[model samples]
Target: MHDRDQDIIVCRCEDLTLADIRALIQKGYRTLDEIRRISRCGMGPCQGRTCRALVQRELQASGINIKDQVPGVFRPPTKPVTLGSIAEGAGRRSDHA
Candidate 1:
């Protein structure tokens, strides 16, 4: 990558760049949760699967020891859910009502 083209996009899913993360860090958002909540960095479809490590690296570089920090919340059902199943469940719920 050329010097001018060296745009470090930490979160492609949320379009978060390195500059964005730095600004958040400068703003006293020390923890990943703070950054994630304010910038929606990890709330994309991939659920930070790709960006978590990058973000952690940035945090560590910023002098924040992330060794003890929880990487991020990962709920169950890691795989994607189908819309058809959602519709089926909704129908079942309505029937019970």
Candidate 2:
């Protein structure tokens, strides 16, 4: 592959390159979940929303049928909740009750 293609960013959230993905595939990382877990590809703020398709495409190109592959597990973003907010919400609920 050309250097330009290698330089292409597959996962912008994690700054992972196409070359990185290819290397992982060559190393026998077949499932999307495996790749994500090992490389943190889909563990970024955007989750796998951005890179999932791109990585899948790569996997397809490498002769892996994505349909049968185990998909990566995406966790919901963790939002920080202050204790004050929780207490205020509880107070409001009590007032309503």
Candidate 3:
């Protein structure tokens, strides 16, 4: 079945729709923490590093005060690096610039 309503694709990895988030907001789900808990927007391969800012903007548009908005939970590493780079050992040092 085709989705009649086209919403913004927030999390490509998790396939979260903007409508889903808006509905949550309409349901009195304010703040990033509440939104994440209900809609799971940032729970994806890239995590919130991808769409946290956009989500915050949308939340602000709804008249929610987000000044003290803290970031969502973070998982391991914080950076996704290639295994080959680690194995190489001889990573690029200085002098290139």
Candidate 4:
């Protein structure tokens, strides 16, 4: 593959390129879920919003119909709370009581 193809960004959040996707497809990865589990392609903060279609396209190009594959699942994004912050909030609530 050409260097230009390597520069085509498929998943910006994960820094994955089109070439990377193609390589995975060539390696017998036929489903979006398989690709996600192996490469964490659609498992980033955007949660497959950006790269799902791209990966599906690659799979289709490799002669795999996406309709037969298990769909990618996106989980709700969670913001991590620090233990100290939780403790502080609890202390404030107790003091008010």
Give the residue spans of candidate 3 off by over 4 A: 1-5, 79-97
Model 1: per-residue Cα lDDT at residue 66: 99
**Residues 30-51, model 3: lDDT tens digits:** 8898887777777666778877
Runs off by more than 4 Å, candidate 2: 78-97
TM-score, cand. 1 vs. native: 0.77
Which residue pairs in model 3 clash with each other? Answer: none
lDDT of 1 by residue, 22-79 (tens): 8888889988899999999988888888888888888898899999898778975586
Q: Can you tell me which runs of candidate 1 are displaced by over 4 Å?
A: 1-6, 89-97
Clashing pairs in 4: none
TM-score of each model, paired residue for residue: 0.77, 0.76, 0.67, 0.76
Q: What are the per-residue Cα lDDT tens digits for candidate 4 across 3-83?
A: 897999999878999999999888887789888889989777777787998888888888998888767655643544678
User: What lDDT score belongs to each candidate, Candidate 1 first?
Assistant: 0.84, 0.86, 0.73, 0.84
**Which ranking of candidates, highest lDDT first?**
2, 1, 4, 3
Each candidate structure's count of clashing pairs: 0, 0, 0, 0
